[model samples]
Target: MARIQTMRVDRMLSSMGYGSRSEVTRMGKAGIITLDAAEIADAARRIAVTPDLPARMKIDGEALDPLTGVVILLNKPLGMTCSHKDSGVLIYTVLPDRWRRRTPVIATVGRLDKQTSGLILLTDDGDLLHRIISPRSRVRKTYRATLARPLAGNETELFASGELMLDGDAKPLAPAELSVVSETEAIISVTEGRYHQVRRMFAAAGNHVTELHRERLGGLSIPDGMASGQWALLEADNIASIFHMDPAKQT
Candidate 1:
């Protein structure tokens, strides 16, 4: 188990989603919180958290375990908005209540529109989340799109040249890779996340995207057997793979 340095009792509890600082203070004063079976009266008392160690806390008479970071890969289904306050069904609805209730609330690394579906990443680690989503990271995302019309002449070269003009912008998008899968289907790879980029790119090319699905991100592909709306925890190797980093090289 990794050992995190000591932190204030209230901060620790609040970080683990136990409650707000004021609420934790109330619990501490009520003697409902214990450290190593001893009543903790000071909310500012510092304590270490080691996951491998035996239970060190009891809240409201129930033994509590130390919290750990988590990463999840969800196979997003159509019609669910990634936003927390969307008018449609929320992506969080697909995850278990336990994860939603945990501290450092799990958040999607990037967004996919409600009409699009496929691999999406979630994590409680803020650093990892920022690394994956940050444009400077230059992580590549691959998508398979179904178009309303057959790919036209020289469009492949146009996309590869990265000079397609998008609305509301004076500059063209960065170069992207495009491959024709069929008359009306194609695969696109890009490192940037522009709003409706794929759809807009096709529109600029005189084509319409009827469907879009993300197939891969960075070095990780959607694992087989993961059905739509299903989710699974990403292990250490999987996390490392997402960033294409060696475990030993991770900060």
Candidate 2:
């Protein structure tokens, strides 16, 4: 089990996006915060942060939000841009206002274009974020693409040949798997995240991707019944699933 850490009530609240020290103190004075069934008397009081602490504490009569180091899985919706600075609807707006002010700041593991949607991860754990996106990880990303035209009949062999190079790319792509779902649709999995990679790959193979949605990253897939614009915090098991290898898809 992970070690249970401790921190001052004010620091914890501030870092977790509850509020600043003064605001938290004000909230405590107003009887809006409690720990172990008692009102907090001091913001500076240090308390053990246990896994069950959120349940043991209440803020405004509701359970405290999850502690920091959170990993979130969001089912992204179409027309929502992932970039924070770019114009148009942004996915971050889907989260709480406090989430936008978190100390470490939750960030996307990798980007999905506005036109594409499906399982996407955001995390405050920087190391975990880097490990998942790092080249050495070779974490597989699977996408379901709708093509503008039918397959050319040789894309499977071409993509699997490990010699396919995208336009303006300097290196050959790593081996990829293609499972055709229909004449104009297929499931493609790749170990790399290059610029417009999935679409570019199809284009390079003489096809155009009309639509795209990421279905899986490694062993983790979008939760069933999860609708677009919906998201939830990922538990340890869910996070671990990201690195699990499937015997069937070794890449």
True-structure RMSD, every candidate: 5.1, 1.9
In terms of TM-score, the best-performing candidate is: 2
Judge candidate 1 at residue 44 and give its lDDT: 87
Model 1 TM-score?
0.77
At residue 127, candidate 1 shows an lDDT of 89
Candidate 2, residues 126-151: lDDT per residue as tens digits?
Answer: 99999999999999999999999999
Clashes of each: 0, 0
**Candidate with the greatest lDDT versus the true structure:** 2
Each prediction's TM-score against the native?
Answer: 0.77, 0.94
Model 1 stretches astray by more than 4 angstroms: 1-4, 7-14, 18-47, 51-68, 245-251
Model 2 error, position 3 (Å): 7.0
After TM-score superposition, what is the CA distance of residue 23 in candidate 1 from its true location, in Å? Answer: 8.3
lDDT of 1 by residue, 85-197 (tens): 77879999887554566677888998999888998998888989998989888877889999999889676788778677899987888888788898999888888888988
